[model samples]
Target: MSQRLRLLSVLASSLLLSACVSSPKKPAPVEDRNPQPARTAAPASAPVPPAPTAPEPKPAPGAENAGKPGYYTVKPGDALIRIALDNGQSWRDVAKWNNLENPNRIEVGQVLRVVPPGVDAAAVAARPIASAPRAEARPLDAKPAAASASAASSAAVTAAKEPAVKDKDKDSAADDDTLAWGWPVANPVTAGFDEQRNKGLDFAGKPGDAVLAVADGRVVYAGSGLRGYGNLVIIKHNNTYLTAYAHNRAMLVEQDQVVRKGQRIAEMGSTESDTVKLHFEVRKLGKPVDPAKLLPAR
Candidate 1:
């Protein structure tokens, strides 16, 4: 019984020593292998885009006037006649240069050519135009042809009523005494009218000699704008007659003024002539006719 008591004490001591020793740690929980990604902040706002623009237009073809010379801008109160007078050109020629459909109709701000396209101003004015061939002079005291269409028409009617066998000399003498006719000046004629050499008659006179209108008419132009006719005066006797008195020292009448037959209209001088003379011309429809054809015999 003593031996059994010794063995039980030893076993009790061993168990106490084992209890005082360290206790077993619990197994660690299984850990996850992968981790979640971190969250990011959102942007405040989106950037603004740019605006679109419009495209440009193109020009049309052949819009410019080509091969033409310098032009003149028309002004108010301007007429083709006045412009032609100022520029030393004929109104008809000016119309031809500008391709004008209506000579009397031109608007302000319209462009016109002052000079001709190919011809020069001085050249055009100096060029002589030929007239019909006729005897230069008839009898010095012979009666002239009718000066105007109206006069000619009346003469025709009178001629028609007269018998074909009537004496021409007697009728001519009577007509010369009845028609309104007068001289342009008191001086002797230095040069007679010739179609080739002279376009009109030249009358020799002292400086400041009175130049008279041969018939009743209205002044159409009174200026020195024409190169060959210095201080010229143009008279419109009727729709079919126009008379020019050139190379005058002074003009006594203005354009559009009325004057009776034998009225003094200018003073004779050597403005563009060789001497102190009156250069007289008669134009029918712009073509020069012999003044002797319309002037009464001296």
Candidate 2:
């Protein structure tokens, strides 16, 4: 019975050891029930560039030479004051140039050398003004017959002193003296010259009409290289004058060709104009002048 009790105790100990060795492991607790999505580093943003701008244009050359005092020839009927204003100089400069005590003493065919401000005052003061020549008159005392003949002679002299009526008639046919003269086309002038705005004159004509030159010159340029002057023709008159014709349908004269006055140089067209017309410009020393002052009266 004692042996049976020992075996039973041993069996109980073995059972306890087996229970300790066969125990299961427990899982760790989760903060969230559902698993979160995997997070990636955000992509770096790119930098943007700025837009570009256009370049500015350069000023015209020799513009600084303008308004400088210089010498000018006095044509027929040119007043001293008028010449001074045309050259951008003052009337005082004209008086000082000619050494005139009175500004109204200027005569035709005179060469006046004008000086600008801050010039030599002593040189101007040294020059003497020219005076007009005087004529002697006949005596009044004489016989009655001689007096009657003298009175008749005086009437003739009085008539000669008066302005010639025939001169008034010829005044309308006077020649234009303005530089860079040119005819627009074989038609009436439709538009006159405007310096700042138009820069030229327009002649009224049908499409494909003949255009002529106003004076003898050589064609310097005969292409449309210049902007706003389509199918252009430029003629060099002298050293100081140039004439330009634009919007032509056909050019009869080529570059460097010598052309005479009233010669056909081009045909009128509407390439640059709404209506068919000739665009004519006369430039004197690179400056534009009124074409009406240069063209003959119709």
Candidate 3:
């Protein structure tokens, strides 16, 4: 029995050893290193800045005088007619604005009403009031003449002071002081001044025909601004007279140029007319007058 016990024990030990050997071995435990912090996303980018803005522009001085606010100070060369032409108004209209009895008179440094009087109260008030010329101081005691002759002479003078007599005298004066009459060209009159249609006289001529000034004058306007009167020249003979030569092929003089009577001022052409001709006009105080009355008889 004891032998049997020993053998059994040996067998049990053997089986135990075999089982332990057959079981799979487990890996050694890894060292517990600090766990990496969870990865965080980078911060978002900063916003971009806005662009800068530009500045506004200012207005210039001496701009167009469309709406006249202040008065126009008359400068050296400020004539009623010139002012009217520059301002696109008529001289008559300007005269009426100032209540001028005579349009011929204006003074330097004078403030003329460019805009209508109703436009601005300040401008109207700014106009310098003109005083009449001081009358010549007559002698308090004068030479006594014969009563009969003085009375008769006074009656005659009173009669001559009438409008009709004054007009006759003015006509005579104009005839006396006016330039010697001369024909501008030998061409016969093709058309005469017609108050209804023709503004002046037309003389048939060839291109490049010599055009003569009617009187001694200064060239006021030498341009093509007047429609239907292309390549024109305007001469101011005096304050009371002006002459125009239109449809000229070429102009020999310029503005403000002094010219003598019967001077060749232009070469005639049909700039705005149908045929080669010279268009001549005589203006007395801006009114169209018959050239035939002033020109030498043909």
What's each prediction's TM-score? 0.44, 0.41, 0.44
lDDT of 2 at 106: 54
Q: What is the lDDT of residue 194 in candidate 3?
A: 80
Which stretch of 10 consecutive residues in model 3 shows the poorest summed lDDT? 163-172
* Cα lDDT of model 1 by residue, 140-182, tens digit: 1222221244434543453354322322111111232344657
- Who is ahead in lDDT, 1 or 3? 1
lDDT of 3 by residue, 108-193 (tens): 55555544556553433322212211112212122212224443454345335421111111111233365665667778899998
* Reference-based lDDT, residue 117, model 2: 42
Model 2 scores a C-alpha lDDT of 0.56
Runs in model 2 deviating more than 4 A are 1-182
Q: In terms of lDDT, which candidate is strongest?
A: 1
Tens digits of per-residue lDDT, candidate 2, 1-298, equal 9999999999999998998889755667768879889999988988767676767755332234333335555555555533532333334445665576756555444556554446653343322112211112111111111123443454355335432222111111222353334465658877877655676788888755777877866665565543355566776565345677887766666655666677777677765567778888776544566777777666
Better of 1 and 2 by lDDT: 1
Candidates 1 and 2 compared by TM-score, better number: 1
lDDT values for all models: 0.61, 0.56, 0.60
